[model samples]
Target: MSDALLDIRGLTAGYGDVPVLTDIALTVGAGEIVALVGSNGAGKTTLLRAVSRIIKASGSLRFLGEDVLPLTPEALFARGLVQVPEGRQLFGRMTVAENLMMGAYRRRDRAGIDASLAQTFDLFPVLAERRAQTAGSLSGGEQQMCAIGRALMAAPKLLMIDEMSLGLAPIVVDRLLDVLVAIRGQGVPILMVEQDVFAALAVADRGYVLEHGRIVKAATAETLKSDPALQKAYLGSDS
Candidate 1:
């Protein structure tokens, strides 16, 4: 945990006066893809909301070794902590390029921003092809790609993706997993909350199993993939 780029200890958060996540402890270390897997209401999204400062969380939170518990959402964004929300929240009326550019609103480096844009387009070629197209007009998979591309536009140090495979075909999910690995190769660690447990384990170096808002299991990806209880719980098969 000493090398963790993002660390959370004793984190608890939820909607107004309603507790959801309880005493959550999670970490994403450098050059690693750490998966958080659980059922729909297991506080997966709530934890992300807390980390991004969209919801208040009480805990010892640190990012890049700096205590970030008091930082505002805007400050967190500027610090290279980015999240790709669960629904692929794209600005429907805006062009693909425009939406991506919005990720760099806080940045003043014109050259770096342009370079990052080119990098994003290269990563998701479909986005480049539809650079001028309105986000609302894209297919579901394309929209997801656009959402991720927009996050990469920010040049994030740590990328947290919620439900990257939601509503996409298995093939599309595989492609995005490949992208996550590629992103990791580029030195950006990822903390992903995935609906597809197998897909998440396949690419992640490690995984944390969340049950009823608490971490029940944490292990290497292969260990988790072969865990009997998890196999039956999520995959519905032990074979």
Candidate 2:
């Protein structure tokens, strides 16, 4: 746990008076993909928001050996704790290239930012082709790709993506999964919040199942895939 790229302990977060997450403990190691899967309204988004400091949270949280509990969202982002938020929240009126450039807004290294942009375009060539087009003009899958490309521009060491497959076609999701594997190969760890339990676990090194904001199960991806209870509830498997 000491070597974890992101670590959380006893984390509780919510909106105003309503509690959504309770005593959550999780870890994402360097160069690993950790999946957080749960039903809708089960506090999956809340957990991500807490880690990104977009919401109030109390408990020990650390990133790369530094405590992040007291850090602001921009501060966390500067430390490579970047979140590709749900809904592919792109600037609708902006060109795809402009949206991607927004990801490096905090960086001072112009050359490194450009290199990251090139890498992003290499990984998502469709984005490069549509660079001058307005972001909102793209299809659902294309929008998702642009959103991911924008995140990659931040040069994140720990990329936390929320709902990578949401509203995407099966083929597009497959392609994104392949891209995620490639990203992990490049040594950037990911902490993903996904609704498609099977797909999330398929690409994950480890997975955690949340029910009512509490972690009900935590196991290796292979073990989780074969779990009878999880299969019945999430994967629609009879056995």
Candidate 3:
């Protein structure tokens, strides 16, 4: 068996009685960057919600070899299955440092939290430059960094990010993607649901293509990037 850190099988979830995701199965192995590519309304965010327990879902969901279907969102997060939602949902009024400190709320070890915060600042020096600044006052990219830094402070084993490059400039996106690679090098697997197929596949080790709430393709990043049909369908390129 592969060393899968987060595994989902036969997952079907939706709002109330309506199903948006159907028989979805995917896995994020240790130290892998796995991207999920799809169009709008394809249930990418819905799948994240289901996995995080923000919404109800059926079937098996495992993390670090533990069955997570029975855990509440808070419990799952404490167990190191953390999510950095789309829109970089920071506590707007809170200072960058305060917002980051929130990520370690479940932890009791003071020294470890301090080390994580220091590591986060070291990774994103711009955040260190703005630690006391209000999160709402930062630029779009800086806010995204803070949001990601906050997740890092939680010491996540698996980081699930939605629309990571959304509404950001190309340079900023590149910077964020680099950080993701570095994080993966440090043995944190990422399950990224990204709107930018090119950007996501560029750094991902593997990718899953979802269309209309169902995964239509799953392969290595190179395979997905090289597929002409996938390019036509998602990138709208006739060539």
Look at candidate 1 and tell me the lDDT of residue 151: 91
Error of 2 at 210 (Å): 0.7
For all predicted structures, in order, the TM-scores are 0.97, 0.97, 0.97
lDDT of 3 by residue, 1-239 (tens): 44588889999999999999999999999889999999999999999999998899999898888889988999999899999856899999999999999888888899999999998998899999999999999999999999999999999999999998889999999999999999998889999998899899999999999988899999999999999998887789998
Off by more than 4 A, model 1: none
lDDT measured at residue 170 in model 2 versus the true structure, 0 to 100? 88
Top model by lDDT, which number?
Answer: 3
- Which candidate model has the greater lDDT, 2 or 3? 3
Per-residue error at 162 for model 3, in Å? 0.5
lDDT of 1 by residue, 1-239 (tens): 36799999999888999989889889999999999999889989888889998898898899999999899988998999999746999999999999999888888999999999998888899999999999999999999999899899898999999999989999999999999999999999999998799999999999998988899999999999889898898888866
Give the range where candidate 3 is weakest over 10 consecutive residues by summed lDDT: 1-10
Instruction: Estimate every model's Cα lDDT from 0 to 1.
Output: 0.92, 0.92, 0.92
Off by over 4 Å in 3: none
Write model 2 residue lDDT over 139-161, tens digit each, in one string: 99999989988899889999999
Pairs that clash in candidate 2? none
